[model samples]
Every structure is written in C-alpha cells, then in structure tokens.
Target: MGIVSVSMPEDLLEEIDDIVETHDYSGRSELFREAGRKLVQEFREPSLEDRDLVAIVSALFPYDSPAVETKMTELRHTHASAVRSNSHSCICDDQGCVETFIIEGELATVSEFVRDVEATNEDVQVEYSLFPVDSIQRPTL
Candidate 1:
C-alpha cells in the first residue's frame, strides 16, 4: 500500500481516535484501512444505486385486454438482465383505461424498455418516471 496524507479537522480527528480506541484498532491506519475496504465494497457491490430503479408507467388500454400483460411479459423477457421486481395495477373507464406498472431495472435498460413498449402499443397512452433508489440502508416496510 502507498502512503498518502490527508488533512482533517480537529473534531473529526478526535472522533476517529475514539472509534479506533473503541474498536481496539492498532492505530488510525488500521481504522482508515477498514473504512476504506468497506467503502470500496459498498460501491463495488450492485446496490440499489447501480441496479435498482423504479418505473411508474401510466398507460391507457382496453378493459380486460391482454395487450398490457403481453407487453409487460415482453419487457420482462427482453430486459431480464436489469429487472429486479415489478408490480401492476389498473384503473379503467368506458373510453379507455389507465394502467400503472412499478418496474425495477437498470436505468438505461428500463428507460429503453419503456420507450419500446410505448411505441409498440398505439391504443395505450404511457408515461413513465424513474424513482430514486436509496442504497444507504435497506428499504423498510
């Protein structure tokens, strides 16, 4: 490992010293080493920020239509690499209906899939947005 120098405020340094002592670390070097390892692992692993995304799709489709289901299935298959989860709900009326889908995928793939699905279905009016994926902690119910 190469040696590097960084400046920290006195208060932060004191906090680091306290952590080092509490953890029984040999010194600040060991404490920083472990923290760096964890930081690297957190970024390297495919956390929500990397692979998690939510797409909320609002579309108009015929009542009791198979088109929506078919399109969703196609999207799932085509973008299987990015998908983590999905859910669908519908609100129907006489003229047409609005369907909503919550889909999780990589940002690019999910965006592309949404575009393709919208293009393929003429009768359906679709709008989609990506929800932020928080990786700092596990999602709570």
Candidate 2:
C-alpha cells in the first residue's frame, strides 16, 4: 500500500476521530481503508444477467424549488415501468419536502436511476438516501 494525503473539513475530521475512538478503530488509516472498500463495493455496476432488486430511494429537497420538482416528475415518468410508485409529503413549514420512490426492475436500471436522482438533487444540495427493499411491497394508496 502507498501513503496518500487528503484534506477534509475540521468538523468531519473530528467526527472521524470520534468514530475511531468509539468503534475501537486502530486509527484514521484503518477506518478510511475499510470505508474505501465499502464504497467501491457499493458503487460497482450491476450486470444484465443479475437478478432485479427492489429498492427505495428517499430524497428530501426544498418543496418550493421548481427545478427539483420538475426533475423528480420527469424521472418518475421516464421510468414508470421500473418505478412501482412514488409517495411525497411535506414534513412541516420549515422541513421542505420528502419523497420516496419504490422501484422494482433490473439492477442496472434501478442503480442508474438512483444515481441520476441523487446527482440532480445534490446539484441543488439536497440530502438523500437509497436502500434495498425486501420483498414486501407497500400498498398503493
């Protein structure tokens, strides 16, 4: 292995230090190594022959942002077959809007759409999370 130097914000570095201490990590190096490995695995492309996966991608963005609203609508329409359903709600006056996309389709297609949604929202500096779903499907209401 080779040594690599990188920089991060002070707050993030402090959080990493806290995690290292709390989780009994050897140090920043070991923690970062493991993190890098996990990141690589999580981002690897899926193959056509692979089984389709059910996934849920939840994104929270400013409800008042026209661009974000349009992007989400277009995404749902473009992937209607893969997108099982979409549920949206507003948490409160100050919390913006939150939406979840239920997707059931080929692994590669789902992954690609998820990445696109994340990038679009991130361009607006929105926060989001994507997770694999179990066989259970929520009833459309």
Candidate 3:
C-alpha cells in the first residue's frame, strides 16, 4: 500500500468521523479504504454501456423537503421517454417519503437519470439497479 493525501471540506470530514466512531471503524484510513472499494464496485459492474436497459430507481428523502421533490419532478419530465411508471409513498411513521420509478431506455439515458437524482440533494438517498433488456426472461404466450 502507498500513502496518499486528500482533502475534504471540514464538515464532510466531521461526518466521516462520526460514522467511523459510530460503526467502530479502525480509523479514517480503514473507513476510506472500504468506501473506495464499495464505490469501485458500484461504477465498474456488469459493463452494460451500449445495451438497452430496464432499471428501477428509488430515492428517499425527508417528507418536508419540497425542493427535492420538485427537482425529482423536473428530472422525470426531462427523461419522460425513459420512465414507464412512478410511485410515491410515505413511510408509515411519517418521517420520510420514497419515490420509485420503473425506467426503460438505453444504458446512457437510464444512467443519466439516476445520476441526476443522486445529485439533486445531498440529503436524498438514492439507489438503483439496472438489467440489460435482453437478459430479462420474458413469458411465452
């Protein structure tokens, strides 16, 4: 292993520290190493760059954040052709809302939509899974 130096905003570093303490990470270095591995796995998987895809995208955010909701709506419109269906639900305890979309399109378009949702709000938690269109098993008539 080699040593490398990096910088982050103090507030962000503090958040990392909090997680490290809460989760009993050995130290910042160990925490960062694990995070780096997870990120690499997320971006380098399945290699479906040129294929048509079907995806499920979901975002969770505090229910009171209208800005997040509005941004999500704008992105949905911008990618309207890719979106097949959308559903919203409030968590039973009323603390948060989840929005889910079933989207089908080329890999690039689906990835762009998911990236936009992830960038819309730092507080929003976004998750998505993509499957190549040809890989899905279709029912025979």
Model 2 residue pairs with clashes:
none
Deviation (Å) of 24 in candidate 3: 8.9
TM-scores for the candidates: 0.45, 0.61, 0.73
- Model 1 stretches with alpha carbons more than 4 Å out: 1-52, 84-90, 93-97, 135-141
Ranking by lDDT: 3, 2, 1
Ordered list by TM-score, greatest first: 3, 2, 1
Highest lDDT scorer:
3
Candidate 3 accuracy as lDDT:
0.87
Please give, for residues 53-109, the per-residue lDDT of candidate 3 as tens digits: 899999999988999889888988988999999888889688999999999987668
Residue 21 C-alpha lDDT in model 1:
94
Question: Model 1 clash tally?
Answer: 0
lDDT of 1 at 100: 57
Q: lDDT of each model, Cα atoms only? A: 0.68, 0.75, 0.87
Tens digits of per-residue lDDT, candidate 2, 39-76, equal 66765744323556677777887758779878889889
Quote the positional error of residue 71 for candidate 2 in Å: 1.4
